[model samples]
Target: MRILIHDYPGYAFPVELARALAHRGHVVCHVHFSATIGPKGTLARMPDDPETLEFLAIGISGTYRKYSLLHRFLQERAYARRLEQAVRAFSPEVVISNAQPDIQARLLATCQDMGIPLVHWLQDLYSTAIGNILKRKCWLLGALAGAWYRHVEKRLISGCAQVVCISDAFASEMKDWGIPDSHVVRIDNWAPLADIPVMDQDNPWSGQYGLAGVDVVLYAGTLGWKHNPALLENLALALKERPKTRLVVASEGLGASWLAERKVEQGLDNLVLLPYQPEESFAAMLASAKVLLAILEPDASAYSAPSKILSYLCAGRPVVVSFPPENHSAQLLSGARAGIVCSSGDDAGFIAAVKDLLDKPENAADLAINGRMYAERHFRIDEIVCAFERVLNHA
Candidate 1:
C-alpha cells in the first residue's frame, strides 16, 4: 500500500518509521517542512538519507514555532496550502498526519473531498498548548482561542480513520475530545535502537570527552524553555561538594545558555557545557553518564512527553526524572524500575535520588540493566514501525 507519513521536520523517529515502511515493500512518501528555518535536530543535519522513500519537502522560511499572532496565522495558512498541493501530487493510499494540528485541520476538508483516509498521530496536545501560550498574556483571549481550537481539534480527530497517541494519557485526552476509545491507538514513543547501542562506561568515547573518571550527571538533549533551567542550576549547586562529580550538558538552547550563565555567576566549577554532539557518539555519551536527567516543568508535563527519555532508556543508563509521579514518564520509569522519579517541586527528593546512586554504586548498574531490558521490549524500531504499519493498513 502507498502511504504518506507527515512528520514535523527534524524528528528522527518519523524518518526511521518511514524507512521501515518503505523496506516492507510499500511505497512511502515522507512529508516534512524546511528544517533549516526551525529547531536543530539530527534529521536536519543527517549526512545521508535513504533513497527508497519519496521526500515531499515543503520549503518554509521563518519558523512557525513563534507564538506571535501574525506569524502563527500566516504560517498555518501557508503550510495548509503546501500540504494540500503535496497530497494532490502524491495521491497516497493513506495519510498519517503527525504534528501541526491547525494545518492538519485545514486539510481535513480537502482529504474528505479527495476521498483519502486521514490518520492523526498525536505527539503532543497542540490545542491545550496553544491555550497555555495564549493564557500567559490574556485570560479571556486564551479561553476564547482555546475553545476555538478544541472545536477544530474535535473535527480533525473525529474525521480521522485512526487516532495514534504517543502515550496513554494522550489517548485518554482523545476520548475526552469525544473520540471513541476504539478509534485511539496508543503507541509509546521509540528510539532508533540500531544506531544507539548500549556501551560500557569505560569506552573510548568517555575518554574522548574527559569523562573517563568523572561522575557525569548528564542532561543530553535540548534543554528547552518548558524545562525549568533553575532546576539544573540547583542540581549543580547540590553537587558542588563532590569534587569528582560534574553536571555535563550536551545541548544548545535558551535553557542551556541560561545554565551556562548560572555556572559563571554561582562559581559552579563542576558544570560542563558543550554543544550537541554528532549522532555517532550519542550512545557513548549516554553510557558515560553516571545518571541521566529528564525534567519537565510541572505545568508542561500534561501536554508533553520528551522523546529524549526513550533514547536514555535505549542507552541502558540510570535515569533521574523530575516529573510528577502521576505523569506518564514517571509511571513508565517507576513501573520498569529503571530509574528514580522525584516530583518537580521536591528539591530534597531530587537531590537524595541523585546522591543515592552516587553513594551506592551498585544501584547504577542495576538500573542500567533494567533500563536496557525495558528498551529492548518496547523501543525496538522494528516493532514500533510494524505496529504503526498495522494501524495504517487497517485504517
Candidate 2:
C-alpha cells in the first residue's frame, strides 16, 4: 500500500511513526512542514526513495503567534498546498496526518476528488476553549483567532475518514468535540528503543552541571512554555536538604533559557540544566537516573498525556509523575504500578511523594523492573509498528 504521512509540528514521535510504517513495507511518502523557516529535525532530510517509498519536503514560515494574520494565512496556503501536492504525487491508498486539522480539511477535499482515503493520527487535542486560552496571550486578535480556530477544528474533524488518537484521553476529547465513536479510534504512541552501548562511559552531563557525584532525578524532553518552570525550582528547594540528590533537566524549546535564570533566582545549587541530548544520549542519561520526573499543569486538558512516561519505562527507571489521577498518564503509571502520581495542584504532596521514592530504594527498584516489562509488552516500537501496518492494509 502507498501511504502519505504528514506532520508539521516537527516533533520526534510523528517522524518515528512514519519510519515505522515504512519499515513494514508500505510505500510511505513523508511530508513535514514547519511554522518557522530553518533546518529543524534531522528526520526531515531522511528519504524512503531507496525503498519502494517516496519522500516529499515542504517548509512554511510564520511567527509563533497562533492566529496572527501571517500564521493563519501560511497555514491556509503553503501548508495546505504541501498536503494536497503530496497526496496527488504519491497516489496513496491512505493519507495520514498528526493533527493538522485545518490542513487536513483541505487535503480531505483533494483526496475525495482523487478517490483516496484520509486518516488522521491525533497525538493531542486543541480544544476551542483550551487552544484559545493557550495562544490567546500571544495572538494580536484574540476573539477573532479563537473563533477561527473553533470553526476550522469543526470542519476538519467532520471530514476525516478516520481519526486515530494516541490514547483514550485523546479519544474522549474528540468525542466531546462531537466526532462520532465510529470516526475515532485509539492507537498509543511508540518510540523505537535506542541503541545505547552498555559500557562505562563518562557521564554526558557530569562536569558542567556539577553532577559529578550526585544521583540524578531527571526530566528529559522539550521544556516548553506549558511546563511550570517554578516547579523545578520547588523540586530543587525540597531536595536541597538531600545533598546527594540533584535535579537534572535536559530540555529544548523556549523554557530552556529560563532554566538557568530560575536556577539562580531560586538558589538551586543542586539543579542542573543540560542542552537537549541526542536520542542515544537521552536513553543513556535516563537509564542512569535514580528517578524520573514527569509533570502536567492543572489546566492541561484531556491531552495531558506525555511521551516521557514511555521513555522512563523503556529506560528501566522508576518515575515520579505529577498529573490528575484520572488523566491517562496517571492511570497508566498506576495500572503498571510503575510510579507515584500526585494531584497536579498539590505541591506538598508532590514533594512528599518524591521523598518517599527516595527513601525506599527497594520499592523503586521493583517499580523499575515492572516499568521495563510493561514497556516491552505493550509499547515496544516494533510490535506497535506491525499493528499499524495491519491497520493501514485493512483501512
Candidate 3:
C-alpha cells in the first residue's frame, strides 16, 4: 500500500512508524512542518533508511507568528495550500492527517476532491482547547471563534475514513461528537526506544553542559501557552536553597520567554535557559537530570498529553509531573511506579516530590529502573506497526 503521513509537528514516534512501515514493504512519504518550534525527530534521511521511505519538510517563507491571531491564520491557510499540493503529488492510497483544525479542515476537502481515503489521527481537541484559552482572554469574541472552530472540527472528523485517538478521553470526546465507536481506535503515543538508549549522568554531553557534578532538574520541550511557566519559576526559587542544584530548561516560544524575563528580574543564578538541543545530544541531555519535569495546565488535561513523559521513561529517569490526577500521563506514572504525580495546581506538592527524589537516591534509582523496563516492554515498534497496518488496510 502507498501511505502518506502528514505529521504537522514532525514528532519522533511518527517518524519511527513511517520507517517501520517502509521496512515492511509499504511505500511511505512522511511530511512535517519545518517552521514549528519544538523538539523534532530525525527529519533528515539516515544512511540505513529503506529506499521506499521518504521525508519532506514543508516550510513557510517567514517566521511563524504564534501569538498573533491574524498572522497565524494567514500563515496556516498558505501552508494548507502547500499541503494539498504535496498530497496531489504523492497520490497515495491512504493519507493520515495529524495537524491543527485549520489544516485538517482544508486537507479533508482535498482528500474528498482527489477521491482518496483519509485517516484522522486525533492528537488533541484543538477547538475545545482554543475556545477555553480564548474565552479567558476575551469572552465575547472568543466565544464566537470557538463556536466556528467547533463546527469546522465536527465536519472534518465526520468526513474522515478512520479516526485514531491517542487516549480513551479523546475517544470518548469523539463519541460525544457523534463518531461511531467502530470508526475510532485508541492508540497511545510512544517513544523510539532505539534512538534514546539509557546513558550515564557523566556522559560527554553532560560534561560539556557543566552538569556532570551538579544536581540537575531538567525540563526539555516546547513551553507553549497551554503550559504553566510559573511552575518552573517556582521550582527555580525552591532550588535556590540547594546551592549545588540547577534548573535547566531547554525550550522556546512564549513560556520560555516568560521564564527568561523572570530569571532576570528575580536574579536566578541557578536557572539555566537554553535553546532546544540537537538530536544527537537528546538522550544524554535527558540522562543528566536527577529528576525530570513535565507540566500541564488543568484546562489542557482533557486534550493534551505530554509526549515528553514517554521520552523521559525511555531515558531511565524518575519523572516529576504537575498534571491533573486523572489525566492519562499522571495515570501512567502512577501505574508504572516510575515517578510521583501531583495535581495541576499543587505547587507545594511538586516541589516536595522533587526534594524527595533528590534526598532519596536509592528510591529514585528504583523508579528509574521501573520506567526503563516499562518503555522496553510497551514501546515495541513491530507490534505498533501491525496495529496501524490493520487500520490503514481497512481505511
Candidate 4:
C-alpha cells in the first residue's frame, strides 16, 4: 500500500512510524509541516531513503506565536494549497492525518476528490483545546469558536474512511459526535523507544549534567497553558528539607520561566531549571532522573496526553504523575504499578509519593523495572507501527 502520513510540527512518533513503515516494505510517503520551534530542532525532516523517494516537507508555519487569529487562518489556508498539490502528485492510496487542526476541511476535501481513503488520526480534541486556551479571556468567544471547531471536527471524522484515536477518552468523545465505534480504532501513542535505551545512573551524561550523586526528580517536555506550574512550586516547597533531592526542569516556555523565577524569589535551592537538551543528550538526560515527572491539568487530560510519559517509562525510571485518576496516564501508571499517581495540585500527596521512592531506592528500582516492562509490552515501536499499518492497509 502507498501510505501517506501527515503530521505537522514533524517530529516524534509519526516520523518513527514512517521510517518503520518503509523498512517493512510499505511504500510510505510522509508529508510534514516545515517549521522548527522548541529545542528538538528537526520539527520537520525527511526520512533518509536514498533508494526510494519517501519523505516530503510542506513549508508551513503551524505555530501561532502571539499572532492574531486572522493571520494564522490566512497562512494555513495558503499552506493548504501547496499541501493539496503535493498530495495530488503523490496520489497515495491512504492518507493518515495526525493532529492536523489547521485547514482540515481542505485536506479532507482534497482526499475525497481523489477517492483516497483518509484516516483521521485523532491525537487531541483540538476544539476543546482551543476553547480551553481561549476561555482565559472571554467565555463567549471561546464557546462560539468551540462550537464551530466541533462542527468541522465532526464532519471530518464522518467523512473519513476510518478514525484512529490515541486515547480512549478521545474515542469516546468521537463516539459522542456520532462516529461509529467500528470506524474508530483505539491506538495509543508511543515513545521512540528504540532510540531511548536504559542507561546506568552513573552514565557519562548524568555526570556531565552534574546529576551523578543526587536524587533528581526530572520534568522534561513542553508545559503549555494546559499544565499548572504552581504544582512544581509546591513540590519544591515540599522537598525543601531534602537537600539531596532536586527538581530538575529541562524545558523551555512560560512554565520553565516560572520555575526559574521561583528558584530565585523563593530561594528553592533544590530546584534546577535547564533548557531542553540536544537530541544526542536527551536519552541520557532522561536516564539521569531518579524519578521522572509528568503532569496534566485534570480537565485537559480529556483532550491531551503528555507524549513524554512513555518515553520516561522506556528510560527505566519510576514515574511520578500528577493527573486525574481517570486520565489514561494515571491508569497506565497504576495498572503497571510503575509509579505514583496523585490528583493534580495535591502537593502533599505528590511529595509523599516522591519521598517514599526517594527513601527506598530498592522500591523505586522495582517500580522502574515494572515501568520498563510495561512499556516493553504495550508501547513497543514495532508493535505500534504494525497496528497503524493494519489500519492504513484496511482503511
Among all candidates shown, the one with the greatest lDDT: 3
Number of backbone-clashing residue pairs for each candidate, in the order shown: 0, 0, 0, 0
Instruction: Write candidate 2's Cα lDDT for 1-395 as tens digits.
Output: 78887776555556666667777777777777654332123454345423754446675564545435566656557668766876787788888776455666788789889887777777655544446454547654555666677678767777777788878767776887799887776788754444322222136545445565567788877565346766777888899999888888887555667878878887888887877675545566775578889887765645557777876787777898778788777888899888888888788888887788888989988998888778778866677777667656555
Distance from true location, Cα of 118 in model 2, Å: 1.2
lDDT of each: 0.80, 0.70, 0.92, 0.80
Regions more than 4 Å wrong, model 3: none
The list of candidate 4 runs beyond 4 A from truth reads: 36-50, 60-75
Q: What TM-score does structure 4 among the candidates reach?
A: 0.91
Query: Per-residue alpha-carbon lDDT of model 3 for 327-373, expressed as tens digits?
Result: 98899988999999999999999999999999999999999999999
Clashes of 1: 0
Backbone clashes in model 2, listed as residue pairs: none
Candidate 3: which pairs clash? none
Arrange candidates, best TM-score first.
Answer: 3, 4, 1, 2
User: Which segments of model 2 are wrong by more than 4 Å?
Assistant: 10-13, 34-50, 53-57, 61-77, 128-148, 176-180, 194-212
Error of 1 at 315 (Å): 0.3
lDDT, candidate 4, 1-395, per-residue tens: 78888876565677788877877877877777665344342333444543333667776556644235676677777778888998899888899986446666788999999998889988888888777767776989888888888788788789998999877888889888899888999998887777778998778877886779888899998766788888888888888998788888888877888888888999998888888787678889988889998888876877787778888888999989999888877887899888999998787888788889988999999999998998888867778888988898778
Q: Estimate each model's TM-score.
A: 0.90, 0.84, 0.98, 0.91
Q: Which scores higher on lDDT, 3 or 4?
A: 3
